[model samples]
Target: MTASHAPFIAACTELLGASHVLTHDHDTEPFLVDWRKRYRGNACAVLLPADTAEVAAVVGLAHEHGVAIVPQGGNTGLAGGATPDESGAQAVLSLRRLNRIRGIDPHNNTITVEAGVVLAEVQSRAESAQRLFALSLAAEGSCTIGGNLSTNAGGTGVLRYGNTRELCLGLEVVTPQGDIWDGLRGLRKDNTGYDLRDLYIGAEGTLGIITAAVMKLHPAPVARVTALAGLASPHAALDFLAMAQRHAGALLTGFELMSDFSMRLVGRHFPQLRYPFGEPHAQTVLLELSDSESDEHARALFERLMEQAMEEGIVEDAVVAESLAQSQAFWDLREHIPLAQAEEGLNIKHDIAVPISSIGRFIEETDAIIARATPGARMVTFGHLGDGNLHYNVQAPEGVDQKQFLEAFQTPINALVYDQVHAHRGSISAEHGLGQLKVDEAMHYKSAVEVRLMQSIKAALDPENRMNPGKVVRWAQAGTRKENIA
Candidate 1:
C-alpha cells in the first residue's frame, strides 16, 4: 500500500475487521477489472461491508479522507460502471456480504431484498411464493440485485414487466456523505416530493450506494409458448411482431429479433446447439407467449399467429415448441449468442435502441453504411424487439485481422450506428448505463440542456466528486456545487 493511504487502510480495517479489508494487490485484483476484461483498474483497498450500517460507516470514512468510492456488486456490468479508476486513490466497496431477503409480502406482491442478493435468487424466491420477479438477464446467475437496480437493467421481459426502474418500489441507500436514506416502502403511490428513489436507481452509484430495494412482483404465468419464426428481413420481423401483438396482445411477453449470422455463430461455436429450421433465413424472431391462462390457449395463440404470418409472407417457416424442455432449448439459443461470439473473437458491440417503427430503417441504413465502409464485416444484430433494444454488433471479416478491424474502424462504426439511432430519435444506450464507456457518447447525442441538467444534479448530490468519480457525468471541481437538482 502507498504511504499516503496507509491511514485510510487502517481506518477501514478498524471499521470492518481486517479480514473484510482487502489491501493486498492480489486480493483486490479480481475486483479491479470488469466482466468483459476490457477495463482494468487499481484500488488501495476493497471494503466488504456486511450491512447498511457498515456501508454508512465506510462511506463516511471515505468522505472524511476525500478518497473516491466505487461501489461494486457482482461486477457483471458491461459499461465499467462498477470498476474503479486506475489512480489507486479509490476504495472499492464490495456489497456481496449483505445478501439477504428481508421479507416477502405475497398479498402486496412485493419482495424486499438486500442489494447483495443475486437476481436469480429473487426470481426463485418469487417462484416459491407462486409469484414472479421478471427482471432477467444472462448474468442473472451472478449479477446482484444492487447492480441491476443501479444500472436500471433491461432484458427480454422489459416489454411486459418494464425495466428495473419500473419494477422498483423503494430503495435503501447510503449517500456519499455517509447518510442513509431509508426509503424502503412497499407502497405503490408516493408523490409527496421529488422522486428521490428514481434519481439513484440508474445513477450507476455515482450518486449513492443502493443497499437494498423493495421490488414489485407479478403472478406466475400458468402457461408459456415459445416459438422461432423465420422472416425475410427486419421489416418482415417488425410486421410479424405487430401481427403477434394483434393476436396475443399482452400475452406476447418477449419478442427477440436475431439475424441468421447470430444463429450461425452459435451453431458453429456451440455444436451441441443447432438451428431448429431446415434452412437458415436472413432474419428470425423468437416469440414467447406467456399468460395466466391454460397451456392449450397459449399454444393455440402462438400457432394462430405463426400460421397467419406465413400466409402473409412475413414468416417463411416456423417452429412452435411443444414441450417445456423444447421451450427452454429455444431460449438457450437466444441466451448463448454472446457466449458464441466470445468464442470466435473480439467484436465491437453497440447496444443501441430505436423506435419500433424505425428499427427496419436503422438496420438497413446502418448496415449499408457499414458495408460501404468496411466490406465483409459481419453484422451480428439481435435483441429485445418488443422494447426496440438492438444488440447491433459487428464481427471482423473472415479474412481480416480482428484487432486491425476494431482499431481501424470501431469509432466510425459506432458513429454510423449512433447517427442512425439519433435520426430515429432513439437512445445510444438502451439498457446499459453510460458508465465510462459512453459518457462522451451520451453527451454527444443528448441535448446541451439535458447534459447540463444531469451535471447539475451530479454536482448537487456529490459536490466533492467523491462517489464513483469520472462516471455518468464529468464533474467540475470540489466546491463548484450547483444550486438546483431539479
Candidate 2:
C-alpha cells in the first residue's frame, strides 16, 4: 500500500476492528470478483460493518478521506455493479455482516429486514408467519435483499407480485455524504413529496447505500399448480398466454417460454430430468397458477384451460403437475437453462424485454438475422413470457471454439439484437441493471434528454461520484462537485 493511503487504511481498521478490515489479497479476493467472474476489481481494503451505525461511520470515514466506496451485498450481482474498479484506490463496504430481520408485522403485512438478509430467508420467515414474501429468483439462496433492490430483480413471481421495486414499500439508505435517510415507512400509500426511497433502490449504489428495507408480504397461496405446454411456435405460445390469462386472471402467477433449442441444451447437460413431451416442439411454455382457494379449484381451472387449448389446436400437448414434487420438477426444467448454457460454453447473454404482443415477431426476425450473419449459431431463448422479459441468449456455433466465437461476434451480435429491441419499442435491459457491461450501449440507445436527466440526478445526489464510480451514469467531472444531496 502507498504511504498516502496508509492513514485511510489505518482509520478504517480503527473504526471497524482490524479483523473486520480485510487488506490482504487472499482475504479480499472473494469480495473483489463478481458472481459471473466476468468482473474482477481491486480495492485497498474490504470493510465489514455490523450494523447501520457502523456502516454510517465507515462511509463517513471514506468520505472524509475522499476514497471511493463500492457498497456490496452478497457479491452475487451479475452486472458487476457491486464490484469496485481496477484502480485499487476504492474501498469495498461489504454489507453481509448487517443481516438481521428486524420485525415482522403480520397485521400490517410487512417485513422489515437489513439489506444483508438473503432473499430465501425472507421468504421462509414470511411463510413462518403465514405470509408470503414473493421476490423469487435463481440466486435467492445467496443474493441479499440489498442486491435485489439495487438491481430491481425480476423472477417468475413478477407476473403476479411484480418486481422488487413494486414489492418494496420503504428503504433506509446511507447517502454519499455519510448521512442516513430513514424513509422506512411501511405504509401502503405515502404521497407527501418526492420518493427518496426509490432513488436509492435500483441506483446500483451510484447515489447511496441501501441498508434495510420494508417489504410488502401477501397471504400464502393455498395451492400452486405448474404445467408444461408444447407449442408449434412463439405465436402459439402467445395465444396460450392470452387464453390462460383470460381463464386464470391474477391467479396466473408464472408464465415462461422456452425454445426447443433451450430445452435440448437442458436435456443434453441434465439427462436425468426427463423431457415431459412425447416429441420435440418448436417452442414450449411453463405455466404456473397460485390459487388462494384450494387444489381442486386450481385443478379445475387448469383442466378447462388445457381442454380449450387442445380443442383449438393451440397446444400440441401438455402436462400438468399432479403433486408438489412434480411441480418443482417442472420448474427445475425452466431454471436449468442458464446452468446448461454455462456447461455448453461462453455465450452472449441478453436480459431484454419487448411488448408482449410483439415478442413472437421480434424473436422470428432477430433469430433469422443472427442465423444469416453467423451461420450455425444456436439460439437459447427463454424467460418470463408473462411479463414480456426474455433471457434471449446466443450460443456459439456447434464445433466452433467458444472463446473465439464470443471474441468475434459478441459486439456485432449485441448490436443486432439491441437494434431489433429498439424497433419493437422494447428495453435493452429488463431486470439486470446496466453495470460496466451495458453502460456505453445504454447511452447509445437512450436519448440526449434522458441521458442528461440521469446525469443530473447522479450529480445532484453524488456530486463527488465517490459512491460506486463508473456505473449507471458517468459524469465527466466526478469527485469534485460539492452540492448537498438533500
- C-alpha lDDT of all candidate models, in order: 0.90, 0.91
TM-scores of the models, in the order given: 0.97, 0.97
In candidate 1, stretches whose alpha carbon ends up further than 4 angstroms from where it belongs are 477-486
Alpha-carbon shift of residue 165 in model 2 (angstroms)? 0.2
Give the per-residue Cα lDDT of candidate 2 at 287. 95
**Residue-by-residue lDDT tens digits, candidate 2, 425-468:** 99999999888778777777877667777888888888888899
lDDT at position 476, candidate 2: 50
Clashing pairs counted in every model:
0, 1
lDDT of 2 at 297: 98
Best by lDDT: 2
Show the lowest summed lDDT stretch of 10 residues, model 1: 477-486
TM-score of model number 1: 0.97
